[model samples]
Target: MRIGMMVDSYKPYISGITNYVEINKQFLEKAGHDVFVFTFGDLDYKDDETNVIRSPGLPLADSGFYLSMRYSRQAKKILQTMDIVHVHHPFLSGRLALRYCRPAGIPIVFTNHSRYDLYAQAYLPMMPEEVTLGMLQAYMPPFCKAMDLVIAPSAGMGRVLRELKVENEIEIIPNGVDLASFQNASPTPREKYGYKSDDILIVYAGRIALEKNIPFLINAFTGIAGAVPNAKLLIIGGGVQQYEEEIRDYVAGKDGAKRIRMTGRIPYDELPAHLSMCDIFATASVTEVHPLSVIEAMGAGLPVMGIESVGVGDTVQDGVTGYLATNDAPSFTAKLTRLCLDSELRKRMGRAAREASKVYSIERATQRMLEQYERLLREPGRRKDKLYFRLREILQRSLR
Candidate 1:
C-alpha cells in the first residue's frame, strides 16, 4: 500500500506524536509498504526509504504547538497518488487531508494524539470555558464525522469524542515504543553522577511545565529524601526558564539539595541509558492522553510510579508492572519510598514492566494499524458503528 502519513511537525521538533510517526514509519516500510510523510519543518531522515513532503504557508507562530497551513494545489496532486491517507493529529494537516481525500474517494484515518480541549484551555486562558467548548463543538465534529475512522491513544480520549457527539467510527489504539532500542541499550553508571551503587535514583523525563504537575513530584521527592537521605532525583527534559528556576530554587531549599540533578533536554539516544541507570521512574501528571515517557521507562526495565489517571491506569497494573498513586504529595512520596527501599520489589516490577511493554511494541502497533487501513480500504461502505467492532477484533488479535 502507498500510505500518505500526515502530521503537523516532524524531525528536529521531538514529541510523542513525532516519535510515534518515525517508529511506525520504519516498521510500516519494513513490512513492505511505501510510506510518505506529509509534514512541516525540516525532516532529517534518509531519503531512500521514507519520503517526506514539506507543506507550504505554515504560520511562524503556530510552528511549535498548533499547525496553520494554507492548503496548496500541490496537496491535491499529492493526495491523488496515495492509496490511503493517515492523519496523526486533527489540526491543519488532517483538516486539509480530509478536505481533499473525501472528494477523491480516498480512505482517510485520523489519530487524535493530544487532548485538544485540555490544550485549548491551557493555551487560551483568556477564553471562557463555554466559549472554548462551543468553538470546539463547532469545529471538530464535522472534521471527525467526515473521517473513515478515528483512532484514539486511550479510551479516555475516545470518551471525550463521544461526549462531543462525534458520530464517526472510533478506535482505541495506544501509542507504542521501540522495544528493541530500550532493551538493547547499555545502562549508565550511577557513580558517574556522584552517586554510590547503592543510592536510590528516581528519574522523571518529559516537559517540566506547570500542567505536568512537576510541583507535586518535587514536593514528593523532598518527602522521600527525609526518609531516604541517599535518594537522588534526576530530572530530564526542558521547560521555560522561569519554571526551571522555580524548580531549581525549590530543590535547593530542600534538605538533600545536592542529590537533585537537572539535565535539560537530553537527546533520544541517551534516554535508554539514563532510564536504565534509575531504579524507579515517575510522573505526576494527570493530563496525558498516552505518555510515551512512562512506556519508554517501562521498556527500559524500570518500574514506574505515576498518578492513577485514565491512560496511566490502563498501562500500569498497580502492584504488577508499577505502582499508581493518588495525585497528591503524600501518595507519591509513599509509592516512591516503597520502590526506593525495596530492591527486590523494584527488580520484580521492572521485569514485569519489560514483559508488559512487549504488548505495545512498534512492530505490533504498525501491523494492527495496517490491518485497520486494509479493512477500511476493502469495505469502505461499512457502517460507522461497525468500525468500532472491527477495531476491537484487530486489537484482540494483536494482543494475542
Candidate 2:
C-alpha cells in the first residue's frame, strides 16, 4: 500500500509526532509498503531520510511549525495518488488533509496527540479558558467527523475528544515506542554524573515547558531534599527558548539547586541509558496525551511518579507500576519521599512498569495501525487511487 503522513512540520523540529511518523514510515517500508511524508516548509532543509515530501510555507518562528493554507502543486499532485493519509496535528495539517485529499476521494485518518485545551491555558494565558474551550468545542467535533477515522493515543484522550462533543468513534491506540534498545539498556555509571551508588536518583524527561509544570516538580523536589537528603533530581529535556530560560533561572535560585541536574536536550536514542541510571521516572505535568517519556522510562525498567491526570493517569497504575499523586506539590512530595526512602518498593514497581510497557512496543503498535489502514482500504470507493496511479504510470511511459 502507498501511505502518506501529513504533518505541520518535520526534521530538525523533533517532537513525538515527527518521531511517530519517522519511525512508522521506516517500519512500513520494511514491511514492503511505499510510504511518504507530506509536510509544510523546510524545503531548504536537507532530510536524511527518503520520501519526505516538503512544500513551501511561512515558518512560524522557532516553534517548528509552518503556516500555509495550501500545499505546493507538486505536493497536491502526488498526495492524490496515495491509498491513505494520516494527519497528526489537527489545526493546519488536518484541515489541509480534508481540503486536498477529500476531493480526490482519498481516505483520511487523524490522531489527537496533545491536550490542546490545556495548551491554550499554558501558551495564551491572557485568553479566557471558557473561550478556548468554546472554540475547541466548535472546531473539534466537525473537524474530527469529517475524517474517515479518528485515533486517540490513550482512552483519556478519547474522553477529551468526547468532552469536546466529538461523538465520532475514536480508536484508542497507544503511541509506539522503539523498546528494543530500552529493554536491553545498560545503566550509565552514576559516578560519571557525580552521584554515589546509594543516592536515590529521580529523573524527568520531556519538554521543560510551562505546561509540563517543571517549576512545580522542582519545588516538590526541594521539599524532598530536606526530608530525604540522599534523594537527587535529574531533568533531561529542553523546550522553547523563553520557557527553558525561565526554568533554568528558577532552578538556579532555588535552595537545593545543586541537588538537581539539568541536561538541556539530549538525543532521543541516548534517553534509555540516561533513564537506566535513574531509580524513578517523574513528571508533574497535567497536560499529557500518553507521554512517550514516561512509557520509555518504564521500558528502561524505571517506575514512574506522576500526577493524577489524563495521559499520566491512564498510563501509570497507581501503587502498582508507580505512585500517582493528586495535582499538588505536597501530595507529589509525600509520594516521592516514600519512594525515595524505600528501595524495595522502587524495585518492585520498576519491574511491573517494564512488564506493562511491553504492550506499547513499536512492533505491536505498527501492526495494529496497519490493521486499521488495511480495514480502511477494504471499504469500497478507494479504487480511484489505483486508477489514478495506473494512468500516471502510463502517461510517464508515453512521455519517455
Candidate 3:
C-alpha cells in the first residue's frame, strides 16, 4: 500500500515524535510498503525508494503549527496519489490531511503522541489553567471525531481521548524502539568522562526543557549522592539556553557538584554507548505519552525510574522492570536511592526491562499501524475528496 506519513517535525530536530516516524518508516519500507514523509524543515536524509516532501511556510520556532496553509496545498497534491495518509500529530499536518485527503476519498489515520492539554500548560504557562483546559475541551473532541481512525501511544492517552468525549474509534499503539540498535552495546570507556569503573552512572536523556521536570531529577540526584558518594548524573540533550545555567547552579550548590556531567546534545549514533555506560536512567516528566528515552533506556538494559504518569505505566513496571514513583521529590529520591544502592535489583530489573522493551519493537508497531490504515480504508463512508474543505469551514465557523 502507498502511504503518506505527515508530521510537524522530522529528523535533525530530534524528539519522541520524530524518532517514532523515522523508526516506523524504516520498518514500513522494509515490509515492502511504499512510504513517504511530508514534514517541515530540510532533512539531511536520502532514501532512494522512499519519498520525503518538505512543506513551505514553516515559522522559525513553531514551524509545525505555522504550516497549515502551505500543507493544505502540498498535501492536496501528494495525498491524492496515496492510499492512506497517516498523520503523526493532530494539528497542522493532521488538519491538512483531513482537508485534502478526505475529499479525495483517501483514508486518514491520526496518532495522538502528546497530551495536548499538558503540552499547552507547559508551553503557555502564562495562560490560566482554566483557559487552557477550556480550549482543550473545546478543541479535542471534534478533531478526534473527524479522523478516520485515531491511535494513542499509551492507554493513558487513550483514556484522555475518551474523557474528551471523542466518539471516534480509538486504538492504543505504543511507540516502537529499534531494539537491535539499542541493546547490549559495549560501553564507550568512561576514562574520557573521568569516571572510574566502579562509579554508578545515572543518565537522563531527552530535551532539557521545563516540561521535562529536569530540576526534580537534579534534586533527586542530590539526595542520592548524600548516600552514594560515587554516583554521577549525566544530563543529555539540549533545549532553552537558560536551562543550562539552571542545571549548573543546581549542581554547583550540591556538595558533589563536579559529579554532574552535561554533554549538551550527543549524536544519535553514540546514544547506545552512552546508554550502555549508565547503571540507571530516570525521568520526572508527567507530560509524556510514551517517552522514547525511557524505552531506549529499557532497550539498553538499564533500570529506569520515573513518575507513574498516565501512559508511562505501560512501560515501567514497579519493582519489576523499573521503579515508578509518585510525582514528588521524596518519591523520586527514594526510587533513585533504591536503584543506586541495590546492584542486584538494578541488574534484575534491567533484564526485565530488556524483555519488556522487545514488545515495542519497530516491526510490531509498524504492522499494527498498517492494520489500522487498511481497516480504515475498507470502512464505509470513507470520502475521497472535498470533505476536508467542508469540515475546515465548519470548524472555523464554530471556533469563531
Candidate 4:
C-alpha cells in the first residue's frame, strides 16, 4: 500500500502532528507499505526521511506554517498514485485532497487533531466567540461529511465535533507514542542543568505557544513553589521566540525565580532523557487532542497532573496513573504539591502510568490505523468519489 500523509507543514516545526506523521511513516514502512509526506513548505528544507514531496507556499513568518491553495504539479501527480491519503490539517490539506484525490478514487481520511474554535479564540481574540463558533458549525459538517472517513484522536474531541453538528460517523483513535525510547531512558544529570539531586522536578513538554496556556502553568506553579521549597518547573519545549521570551519574563518576575528552567526545544530523539530526569509531568493546557507528550512522559515512568478535559482527561487514569483536576490554580497546585511532596505516591502512580502508556505504543497505533485502511478498501461503496463530489456541489449551491 502506498500511503500519502498531507499536512500544512512539516519538519523543523516540532509539533505533535509532525511527530505523528513521522512515526506513522516509519512504522508503516517497516510493515512493508510505502509512505509519502505531501506538504507545503520551504523547498530547500532538508527532510530526514525519504519520499517527502514539498510544494512551494507563502511563508507565514517564523510560525512554521505555509499558506497554499493547491499542490505543485509533481505533488499532485504523485499523490494520485497513493492507495490512501491521511490528512492531518483539515482546512488546507483537506481541500487539496478533495480537489485531487477524491476524483481518483483515493480514500481520504481526516483526523480532527485540533480544537479550532478554541484556537480561533486564542489567536484571533478580537473575533467574537459567536462568530468563531458559527464559522466552525458552517464549515466542519460539510468538510467532514465529504471525507471517506473522519477520525477523532480522543472521545472528547469526537464529542466536540458532534456538538458542532458534524453528523458524520467518527472513529476514535488515540495518538501513538514510541515507548521504547522513553521506557528506560537515561536521565540527564541534575548537576548539568544546575539543579540539586533532591529537587522535585515538574516538567511541561510542548510548544510554548499561546494555546498551551504557559502563563497559567506558571501561575499554578507559583502557588506550589511556596508550599514545597524543593519543587521546580522545567519547561522542555520551544515556540515563537516572542512567546518564549514572554514566559521567561513572567517566570523572572515570580518570587522563586530559580525554581523555573526553560530548555528551548530539544531534539525529538533526546526528549526521553529530559523526561527521565523529571519526577512529575504537568500540563494546564485544555486544547489537546490526545497529547503525545503526556503519553511520552508516562512511558518515561513519570506521574502526571493535567487539566481535566478532553485528551488529558481521557488518557490519564485520574488518581490511579495520575491526578486530573479542574483547570484552576488551587486545585492543580494541590495535585502538583501532593505528587512532589509524597515520593511513595509518585512511585506508585508512575508505575501505573508506565503500564497504561503501553496501550498507545507506536506499533499498536500503526496496526490500528492499517486495519482502518484495509477496512475502507474492502468495504463496498468505499470509494464514493463521484457521489462525494456531486453532494459537495449540491451542498454548496444550496448553501449559497
Best by TM-score: 2
**lDDT, model 4, position 114:** 93
lDDT of each: 0.80, 0.90, 0.81, 0.91
Give per-residue CA lDDT, model 1, range 1-400, as digits (tens): 8898888877656677877888888888889988888876443344444477765544455234434554445655665567789998777787778676665567889888776776677768898888888887887789888888899888877888877667787898888788888988788877777878878889999876666788788788888887887788999987666777888887788777788899887888899998988889988888788888899999999999999886787788899888999877787788889998888999999999999999888877887898899998788453443345446547886999
Q: Which parts of model 2 have CA positions greater than 4 angstroms off?
A: 384-400
TM-score for each predicted model, relative to the true structure: 0.87, 0.95, 0.90, 0.94
Give the TM-score (vs. native) of candidate 2.
0.95
Candidate 1, residue 270: Cα displacement in angstroms equals 2.0
Worst 10 residues of 2 by lDDT: 381-390
lDDT, candidate 4, 1-400, per-residue tens: 9899999999978899999899889999999999999998879988878999999999998898999998999898789878889999989999999999878788899999998988999999999999999999999999999998999989999999998999999999888888999998999888889889888999999999999988988888888887898889999999988878988999999988888999899888889998999899999999998999999999999999999988899899989999998987889888888888899999999999999999999998888899999988887775566356556757886999
Candidate 3 per-residue C-alpha lDDT over 1-400 given as tens digits, one digit per residue, 9 for 90 to 100: 8888888777566788877787788888889988898876553455433578876655565322334355545545766778888888777787777777776778778888887788788889999988988887788789877877888888888888787677787888988888888996888799979999999999999887778888888888888887999899998887656766687677788777788888987887799999999899988899988888899999999999989887677779999999999999898898889899999999999999999999898878877887888777677655424356456656886999
How many residue pairs collide in each prediction? 0, 0, 9, 0
Sort the predicted structures by lDDT, highest score first. Answer: 4, 2, 3, 1
Of the two candidates 3 and 4, the one with more favorable TM-score, higher being better, is 4
* Per-residue accuracy of model 2 over 102-188 as CA lDDT, tens digit each: 876788999999999999999999999999999999999999989999999999999999999999999999889988888898888
